[model samples]
Target: MVASVEEVSSSLVREYLSRKGLKRTIACMDEEHPRTEASINNRSQLRETLHIEDLYRKNKVDKSPFKTLLEIIVKHHIEQFVSLEPNDTKADEITSAVVCGKQSKIRPETEEECPSQPSYRSLMCEQDGLSSHDHIASANDSDCQKSQPLIPFLENNVSFGQRKPDINTMKPEDTQRSRSNRIRRGMMAGPVPQESTKKRQSRRAEVSQPLLSKEEENKQAQERLLFTGIHKKNLERSLTGISIADCGGGKPSGRVQSENSNGKVEQNMQKTRNVKTEPNLSDLNVSELVLDDIDDDDLREFSKVSLQRTVAKCQYTGRPMDKQTATELKAVLLGSSLNYFSVEWRNQSFTFSEIPELSYGIVQRKGGPCGVLASIQAFVLKKLLFENTEISYTGLQRLRPSNATRRQCLVLAMAEILWRAGEEKQATVAIKSGKSHFTPSDHFRSEEVLEKIMCFTVDNLKDLQFILEQHIEQFDSGMLGCILLTISAVLSRSVEKVREDMDVPSTTLIGAHGYCTQELVNLLLCGRAASNVFDNDMELDSGNGNMMLLKGIKSHCDVGLLSLFEHYNICKVGAYLKTPSYPIWVVCSESHFSVLFGLQRELLTNEDKGLEFDLYYYDGLANQQEEIRLTISIGNLSQSFQEVDTDLIPPLELCIRTRWKDAFVSWNDTEPLL
Candidate 1:
């Protein structure tokens, strides 16, 4: 039973050793050992023991301290098994030669005859001469034997295979020197040097060596091909997935049901990471891909065309502007420093010549060309043509009867046109032919257009005033009176300085031919005239004429002249006549007599009348001699009318009184009393 147990345990150990691939040779056991009991339980216990031993071996190999030893043993076994394959003897010999040369130490030759039969070790030493400090010092010396090229027979095939040499294979100092040499070479080659012929040869030699065996190459090639094919398919699949994503695959799961209802979108996402996507350039439309190329001139032309079209549309529609059009027009008008063109339908022309002048006050008052006025005129003409049915072309022609009449007719026509155009002032001026001196119907054989003229004149106060003052004779007395009253009212309301400057009273009598009866009284009473009337006319009789003039003046004097004097606040009248010694008697009109009487009464009535008063009348009957009349009055009344002595009067007073009496008599009998 013990032997059976031993056999079973040995069987188990053999099986374990075979499975673990370990070399095993069992040792013969001693035969004098006691026999062990063998029951079913013991056999089971042996099995259990064997299992435990196997577990212990595995633990020692896989974990901790013994694992390194296990790996070394495994590696040794693999190397031995692999080395059983046949290899080339020539290759082996060459490899041994190279290794032997690398390990050998050879001394440098002396300066005599070179050493015969140079050893492979000497060749290796020469090839690796950079290791010596002396070789570095003699680097520039071409004559040095150490400078000779080494490995002349070996092809320039120094290949750096993927299975690089382990650092442990070389001495640490040698490895450091090799790295320094590599760094020095790199430094010598600057950034962009041409590849030397030696480098090309080395690269060719490296590629020529078959680092990968045929089987391995084939296997790797197949793998690469498969990977490439899979990659392409994956790329296509990813592209399809991208398209799906674009078409709602990336939407909430609730929005889209998947075709394969695995309920695990996360898995699909994981698969997606393994794929690549390529953009489909062909899918883009040609038109969408190409952008239009525009030039500066083209853009400018487009803008011009668009503006012109918009303007044309606006003109054609005749509808009130919508917000957009109005806004555009406003922007254009404000933004641009140019005038826009407008069509004059009546004129049948397009022009920018009539842009409105943005200004205040009377149109054309300044001497510049009147753009606003011209525009208004053109507008009026258009309105006339369209609205006034009675004004045909022939009628229009009749309206302008002659070249001289043309201005008047045109003004009338303009006025009418303006009236129709809703310009009341201009329209009224147009219809009043006489008022504007237009005589519109007179040119066409129409009757005295007085009513229309008056209407026009009345409507335009400024024009009427201008006409009345400028062409005074053209207006009737009634019209002139009306104009004067209007002017007076205007003056009263106007600036005081202007009224004073104009001197309305003087202006009113500016062109009067002669002083009328009433004007004479006003002049005297209001103190508006210069003193002493003198005339050069000497032909007329003075006695009756002078007496008649005095009576006429007395009759005209009434309370009106006195009231005028009071209103003007005339304190006193400077004496033109004085009294004393001589009585200068003269014949004169009754008007002159009346004037003298009034003067005598005023002087005598004054309590402060310091100077005595006298009147003299002269009739220019003789050429040299003068006739004079004098009267003296005192107190508030002239009680005693007596002739003063000639010698008593001052000479100047006598001369003045005599001359005035003669002048008054001559003026009274004139053709028309002024």
Candidate 2:
């Protein structure tokens, strides 16, 4: 095999052996070579290099602990801390030399040298005994500096005195004539001479022109000085009682009175001057000086006097205490706030009336979708289009369904209309597609669709209502969806059919924007005596909500035989009901609504009747048919509740039944329904 190692001199091998404290290896070799002093020194250096190479190859080289650390730090600092300017080629050379552990010959150009550096010429001088390499570097540096000049220190080049000129100074022509000039010119007399229009216009133009030339400027300055001087001189002359022509050129005099004149005697002179020579006081404009000594009482008296006078300026035909006009004015003032009563009087006695005329009135307002329905019923239903609309008109009364069966007839008619309008199918698609407003086909015009549906109207509206109620129980009828349903019912069925279905004479299609509860209640009283008057009238002597609920209940009860209470308060079950209204009552909880019918009326009226109530609840959305028996004796009734002869039974305490639990209720809990 070929030897992998290089041969060492015998002397070097001997030195290595001596350093290792081993026996001299040269004694074992043949002593044929002569050793001179020069040869020994050469052999010693060879031994040192050989030993170093061996140690390095064997991975046993001795080194400072900080040497490798220092080299790594220097390389990192060169790459990280050094910032290279744009096109700084010298920076690249320096970085490369440092990284390679070689000296960098690249020197910064003279111009590029730090401002704090020593002489610039010495850095590039070839006469400094530098070699050819240094000369070449200097030449390259000069070329670089010539190509890229040093940047000036911008921070030290701040300007000190220069400033922007003002706008007024730059354009003196834009300056407006001073206010004093106008006052001074106003003193000039008019109608002195009538020059030709052309000459007058030319003079005006010259006057209005800007003061541009130096001569014009000097002229204006002199005029200003003359104005001040003449005004002072004229003012002094006026104090001396000189004539106007004697002072300045028969110019008009100013209104400024001379302070040097007598305290009271000047007034006599002023009157004579105005009458004989001066113009009218109006033209002179002394209005600002004409003041009256008016204190607070004087102002009051003036206002009183003005108010006492009416359309005609003539005095009232009566004395102050008995003036009919004054009485009339007082009455008008009181009538303006007739709707609002004074509440500031302490210890004031309030009158109580058995009738509801003095009771706190509740103005009915229709709100939300319910309001929309009410508006259509109260306004749209009475139009000529629906004037003749009734059950008889629909040709459904021929079947002779009893009054009890009218609701069934109306429901059937509504269902037939929906079926004809194709809303049922559209609604199903909307539900499946998870969209609320999508109506699938536009095959029929809205009115035509309604008319067609009416043609197919079912005779029994109640049965259809029940089915719809059941369907809605399991589904969410969006607000719009529910409103549309009500609208379709009105369009397809006659007013009589709707009346029967809703158990109220007036059926409404209400919504969030259109109608309110007050309007809805008013609509429910349609065809009744109460319906003719405004729902807000205190003279009507009935609470709007109670009146509406009573009117609806009267349609289903035998209340026509009894006298209408005519005067009633709100939230009272029997306030307007003269007969037994226990058979049906509308219940509302929040936005959800239901109707309750008494299942055991005779039991309720029994002399031994307990505090229990048996009601049949009909929820439109839930389609629930529940017999809710609740104890209402624990619920408190108002102390003011009265048992009138017209009332059928004691007022039923309002209560809410959620699931199977019963709780007392407030009329405020429900909105439009209440």
Q: Which has the greatest lDDT?
A: 2
RMSD in angstroms, all models? 53.7, 40.2
Pick out the ten consecutive residues of candidate 2 with the lowest summed lDDT.
Answer: 353-362
Q: Each prediction's Cα lDDT score?
A: 0.29, 0.30
The sequence of per-residue lDDT tens digits that candidate 2 reaches over residues 1-674 is 32112333444443444344332233233133323222322332453544443433333233432222223334446546466674566765565444534444555455354322123223322123323322223334344333432223321232344332332364444322322332233311121244565455335434533436656555544543443334433332332333344333344333322223221111101111211332221222121222232456546744443333321232212111112222221222122211111221111111111111111111112223432222222221122112233333322112222211222233333343444333233111011112222221233122111121111223343434444443332112222332334333333333334344332334333322332232233223232222222222232235654543323332322111111121232232232332233333333333322334433445324433124444333333332222233333223433443232424322222223211122232323222122
Residue-level error in angstroms, candidate 1, position 70: 99
Error of 2 at 584 (Å): 4.2
Question: What is the C-alpha lDDT profile of model 1 across 620-673, one tens digit per residue?
Answer: 111112213344322322223125453443333323333232111222222221
* TM match of model 1 to true structure: 0.12
lDDT agreement of model 1 with the native = 0.29
Candidates' TM-scores?
Answer: 0.12, 0.21
